[model samples]
Target: MTNPVPKTAMTMREIRHQLGHPVPPPGVPDAEVLPVRFVVSSVPEGHNARHAYTINVHYRGEGMYSVGHGLAYADGDGAWSYEPSRSGEDDEHDADGLTWIAAHRFELTTALRLARRLAPTLTVRGRSVADVLADGSPTAEGTQR
Candidate 1:
């Protein structure tokens, strides 16, 4: 019996199938889908406190010359950023176009789930005043936090 495929491999395969693209053979150009995570942090100097949020999602498709798209979930919000930007190359434009559409659909389900969890945290705080300089540089006296 054949060994079970690794979860990472399975995920890649699922993404390819979802995009309706066949797996490429060795030495041939193939498309790839990857799950990616991005974290955003707030850092303050002279203070020990820090806050970070990691966002995880899939980035699929192929290279610049091949038709592919890279997609990711934005940090904390569950919104997806779909990259449909086409690199003007003859070999991969068609494939990339198709992949772009596929990636957008792939993120919808995940985004909805994540959004629900994040909705409660989105609130605005009152504004505070700060100083500025005419040359777009902060004055030395205003540097103190």
Candidate 2:
């Protein structure tokens, strides 16, 4: 017997519509879409492990444009996670406070592809601002910075 193929989850357009965000213009470069699925695992520390989540963002540009995935996590007990895509490094809390080690960005296409891959594992409930934010929430918050 042959195994059945899985159906397509959602297209970039469909996802954007579902999420209530405007889709990027056709052929537009460096356009970004949000609320991609990501997973979080903790890094062992003194007693607790640090949790982090991955996010996919799209960027359209000229010669070099692609989608990319980013890691984000909380800092200490802050409300927001320090986004790796923005900082470009692993943010850490030290005597000097929050410091980012890396600074990286992603392409729009790459991010869309990653989001498509991760959508299956992502759980969705209602359509609300908080829900959207929660859906987009990173597994962990950034460090003290």
Q: Candidate 2 — which residues are off by over 4 angstroms?
A: 1-81, 84-104, 124-145
Q: Report the C-alpha lDDT of model 2 over 52-137, residue by residue, as the tens digit.
A: 12333433234222222233422222222344333335344341232332222234444444444543333223333234344443
Q: Model 1 lDDT vs. the true structure? A: 0.39
- Write down the lDDT that model 2 would get: 0.37
- Candidate 2, poorest ten consecutive residues by summed lDDT: 44-53
CA lDDT of every candidate: 0.39, 0.37
**What would the TM-scores of all predictions be?**
0.21, 0.22
**Model 1 stretches astray by more than 4 angstroms:** 1-82, 86-91, 106-111, 118-145
Clashes of 1: 4
lDDT of 1 by residue, 1-145 (tens): 9998876546565688789988665566665454343222222323222122223333343311111112333333334455556766754876876665554433535544553454333222331111111123322344434
Clashing residue pairs for model 1: 67-92, 67-95, 67-96, 68-96
